[model samples]
Target: MKILDRYILKSFITTFATVFIILFFIFILQGVWLFIAELAGKDLGVWLVIKFLLFYSPKMIPLVLPLSILLASIMTFGSFAENYEFAAMKSSGISLGRAMRGLTIFIISLSIVAFIFANNVIPKAEYKFVNLRKNIIQRQPAMAIAAGQFNAIGDDFNIKVNKKDGEKGEQLTGVTIHKRKKGEEYATIIKAERGLLTSSESSNLLQLELFDGYYYEELKTKNVRDEKKMPFAKSTFSKQIMNIDLSMLNKNNMDEEQISQTNSMLNISELNYTLDSLQNSYTKETQSIHDNIVKRTTNTLSREISTSERDLSNLEKERDTLKKDKNNLLSLLTTSKKQRILDIATNNTTSNITIIKNSKAAQNERMKNINNHWLAFFEKFVIAYACILMFFIGAPLGAIIRKGGIGLPIVFAVIIFIIFHFINTFGKKLAQENGIPPFLGSWMSSFVLTPLAILLTYRATNDIGMINMDSIIHQITKPFQKLFKLKSNEE
Candidate 1:
């Protein structure tokens, strides 16, 4: 490497390291504050909290890198400007572009690092962080039994302990277990002289060993005729062990549905597969809708034809039967002069025919509505690529911002990212419920941001210039008064 290149690279590395350390400490402090908040009402060890923060650090790198770069750049340039190093370089026949060549190389390298973090490290860390939270929440039951407080482990299990000894690895005095199960309550109150917890891997059990304690177990059995109760008492001979299946206490183990999600721990390939599956789902949904439409249409027409035939048959039967009845009535009428009976028979035939026509019209209208819904379902499949589009938009935006610091940049990024995120989310909902074009709704953020990024980058690069803020502000404000005719109109 050239001497200038080496020099510039060294400055950038030092500045970046300084900025990273500063930002990292800030982030760690924030994490600590959050950890403290989480620990406020709980019995958790400080080391365990620190361990969680350490595990979570890698996930912050992606957010931190960009912000670090921005701050580092500002500091690096500001230092050079302050020392007149830039001026000296310019006077020594080195152009600004030439001096910046090494910085550009450094920026490109950082960009690659950022990309790697975003693509690989961040995803894994995120997965781990989520799992860690689940693990902590699940394991907290074991940790919750502190000195001098009543702690509830699960839905119906309560425990209290008085002094805990570090050397003996046991708790002393005041142990209570209140267990309730399925409309039955059982309380085991113990004033143990000493207590200790022991676990066995083979049996997957956590045993609470209490020494010198009076024990009581209340059992109630439901009966159709009468209820029964049993009481037990124990004075410590040597030891009393209460066996609990620790695996059952492990909430993480029971939540299999949570583990089944692709979003939880998926790699890029898995994400791609999920996206493909969603696409395939939409495809199948569309095909099913089309198939349903065709089947429904054919069934409706067939049913209509059958109904008409049945109606005609009924009408003919009615007419034939009525004619017979009328003939009978006529014979009766001739015999007895009964004109009212003949008039009532004619009215009944007309009413039956009118009912059949109305039923057929209603069936036709329902079939039309079904066909329209099927057509709408087919249209939604085209917009499924919006997820991929939004990702591209977000990734490029991180680069364009140039300020890699997580403070404001991260806030901005998240705000922008979430806005895009929610837009896509709401768009999907709209598409599902209101028959909106899923594609337009889903890709709206990407479409809006792509042009905005391009325009900003163009202005930042060629014309307006990102660093030349004063000049750009002056230019804008100078034209604003003239365009608005404020000063000229006053004159």
Candidate 2:
């Protein structure tokens, strides 16, 4: 262990740790803001909030770790180069590779740690985080129903509101509720132009007060005549109140993770198994759907051909009658029969359209889920590779730029990271929509930046500037210079 190597490692580590802590905290604050809806009025204690943040912090590591390494590498090496430390090393016969050997080893070891953390630690954290949120929402039903898309209160009620106002978010607008009743003709639906959610005097109940709304219930009738009439009941209301039972909801077992199979909650091996099963399921369902659609579309084609033996005696007479009338096929049918045929065709077309529309939505959702799992599988490897990639680029770039201490070095690191992040996001989104393979999308940033890393390493090692300004200037002025010389010659 040479003193120089030790010094270099110490410097890099110091910068990396400082940058990591700052960035990690910043990102945590951003997380808090992003999930304020779940946190603000929930009465979750300080310790619970801290626990929630702690559970969420692990997921930020993949983003924070690489960027910290990049910025730290740039600052440390850039300071060394700016201070003529590289020149001193070069004078002492210590090459650039030798100077880098210590940091490279450290980075490789750190990348391995990153891989383990991403594979093992992050998934467990995600599972816990999801479950904790679920438990919190369960205990506080108002949090779930405050403002968002459809949120369930046990198995009975689904509540949604267009907007929420007031200090505790108890005030609501555009409220809609659906009550689930098994074996009923249809679930009772309650909609209100305005609504309020309030804690009931009884601890086991929550009061939902609705205004200017309608209650709709479709009646299930045993009588065939009444069923044929399709009876339903509707009532208009100025103000209505409902007491929702909360005793069953207060079971706060945070450790009981009901959702164990989310894509983010699985390790690489689990993801592989899940992905295979999903793909197989997708294939089987797709094939079944294809067969069903084919059977539906070819309903008329697959039928028995109605070849009837026409009376030979009447055939010539019928042909003569058709020739005399100059009639189309429609003219032969009665108007009532024609209308019935048209109605049947229209009904069949409408049914097929409905089936396709419904199938498309479900199939697309299934495909999106599969893509997300594949992305999760690939991302575990990506974070590890990204660490090495960022270091390689940043180290050499710093040495070349020879500027440090949060000036040009920060600019370079930010620009490069932005490009990387943007490309990575684009690829994942594309993959999610099935526009590209998840493998390609996940590693797209690495593939695009690998050559740049190589180029920077080559330039810095060989003592070349970022650009040969002399050559660029010569090329840019060559045509103008030639034109000026020609004019001078003509003069």
Candidate 3:
């Protein structure tokens, strides 16, 4: 390696290591804060918290790598600029581009690391993190219950333990259980001198061992139920095993399958399978939406036709009744001259019935309009994959920023990231509810940003100061004004 190359490489390495360490601590602190907040009242150990953070580190690496690269580049170049090292190198006929060659190697290496993290490590970390969260939540009931607090584990169970010993929950001076079954109510109160909780793995049962305790059991009846008290001479085992189905937990163990089959962990063949599966899933969803639209439209049309027929039948019945009333009024009018007023009343009633029928028809038309709108709305996930477009824009922008220091680079990255994130979310909502083209809506930000990123990169690389907005505006305006003046003169 050349002296200049070694010098540049050393600067990059030092800056990258320093930035990574600082960012890693920041991430850890944020993670610890979140964990602490989540487990505020629960009994979680420091080791468990540390393990959680370690498991989460792989996912953070992808985000951290890009920023680290940016900061390293900026600091290294800035330091060279500050120390006149760049000037000295330039005096020796070494161009700026040549000095940057070693840094480019570092950036390429970081990019590879980023790819590895994104493709392999991040996905596994996500899977593990999800499983870890589930495990924690499943075991939370035991961990959350304090010695004197009434703990409600489920809809029908509330328990309070006065004292808890190591591994074994014991010294239960007062234990109260209020349970409500589907169609019955029961209450059990025990004043035990000592108690122990034991778990059996073979049967998956948790047993509560109570010693020298008096048990009062009450069952609700049609009349006021009486409490039955029983005295135990020695240790009485009142074991109520929680029938927690572990099927879901067992299913969660299928992370291995995801790890084995997913593109993140798999080679070319497995990635193909994963992509095929995703495509198939998306296709199936589209097909399902199509089927649902067809079925719903058919059902809606059938209902509208049925409702119209019912309305027609009701109108016909009303017409018949009005005709009968009219005939009765004519007969009355012929018999007595005062009955002519009754004929007018019968006609008015028929008119009102006709108006009601028209109103109902209008309502049916409105319902059909609503159903059509909803059908159009549900068909928009076709564009959900368009979010990948933003990645192309974001990645290159990072490269163009040149000053890879965390400060400005991080702020810019975050702004871009947030904008992209919001665009995706907004597009999804619009597509789902408003019947927007999911593809167009979801890819809108990407479409806009890609050209912008390219333009900016080109300008930045050519040393055409990216911040020269005023000059660009003046150039554009001046050309247009000159063209307009020339046309006026020609006229």
Candidate 4:
């Protein structure tokens, strides 16, 4: 029994290591492809690209680990069963249950380690990956600008270039620039036939030198009352220079603590803390909204709470008097007065509807944030449990199929993983949008797959064939067989 356990354990470990390495490589390449647009053509250096891949690798563990476990389990068990080893063990009075005990214990332990890795290591990796990418892009300010598109330079100006050339990508052609200021429009515009971009490594300053350009400035008086026709000045220059401040891009100013406030950068305990805060904030916001609506209604209606019943009775008496004099009042009123009354009612209705819509919109946004926090809280555990669940599915499936090696195992593993992925993604979207309770939405895939795993295990243990193609085909043709027999008897 000890020998058998060792054999199974050894097989699973070797297979798991190989599968994990291959899958990791494949996923990293896929990730690189997805982010190629940002990482490529930037001359970010080989080490930076390597660092990006290293930092990004942890994000793929939750996805890759479970699939590796599933495939390794299938391959291991299938190889044993295919070689008649399971039959020999059964002949010696060892049951399938006993055979699985060693592997099951190993899988349970692995799941715990995987869970801890997800909770601890992944958050830090996510933070580093995000900030490093930002820092890299920020360091190369010129790479951030795109040709043939308006790009803002530190909120001070907008510049566009038709073409970017030269080995250093410093040459710009057919340039257009507009100067911006706070609380004002673009007061100045500049167009150039060509421009050069330069920056100093020691100082956070970007310089743009334009040649053969025209500058246009619009002049306006500060006092609105004394404003005359707006004057404009236009000047053409052979060369001009502009300086842009890049102090904000300084790496010293980067605040990792502030960035880690997002859910992606928090572990389990932090997620729970965030969730609690969000729920508390949501409760306060709802209360505030209710109080605000009540206050607004009270102010707009202009009615005293103490005089409510008296006002109602008095208002009824006035309404009766008004009803009695309705015809007389209509005859005495001017057309403009009637029209003005109608306009006031229409405007009030429209205003009330608009207020309700805005209030609802704000409430929905608050609820969405709360739901997102809850989803993040539940997702950590769901990913951990999915590991154990996948193993159960793969082990039983391998026993039923009785095939070995990578070919059949990979096919089944990929198919099962795709199904799991689809369910998880769909459930996550539903949870984020508040379509379902966060707990239910987050655990939906596990809840669905667990029962399938159980059913497969039961069938495998009971020696029942899940897919008997011959039986299915026979059942379908039975109706046709009966019809032919009836026709032959009649003939």
Top candidate on lDDT is 2
Runs off by more than 4 Å, candidate 2 = 142-242, 247-252, 297-299, 302-304, 307-358, 467-491
Better model by TM-score: candidate 2 vs candidate 4 = 4
> Residue by residue across 347-422, what tens digits does model 4's lDDT show?
6568767877887888888788877777767767877898899989998888777878988778889999999989
Residues 273-352, candidate 3: write the lDDT tens digits: 55465556545655665576556546643443332323566556667666767654232223333343345446545754
Report every candidate's CA lDDT.
0.53, 0.86, 0.52, 0.80
Q: How many clashes in each candidate? A: 5, 0, 3, 0
**Predicted candidate 1 versus true structure: per-residue lDDT over 214-268, tens digit per residue:** 6556544566333333344444435778766557555454122243433424444
**Model 3: CA > 4 A from native:** 37-50, 136-141, 144-196, 209-491
TM-score leader? 4
Stretches of candidate 4 off by over 4 Å are 146-152, 156-194, 214-235, 251-260, 303-349, 468-491
Task: Supply candidate 2's per-residue lDDT for 348.
Answer: 67
TM-scores of the candidates in the order shown: 0.52, 0.72, 0.53, 0.79
Greater lDDT among 1 and 3 belongs to 1
TM-score of candidate 2 on Cα atoms, chains taken together = 0.72
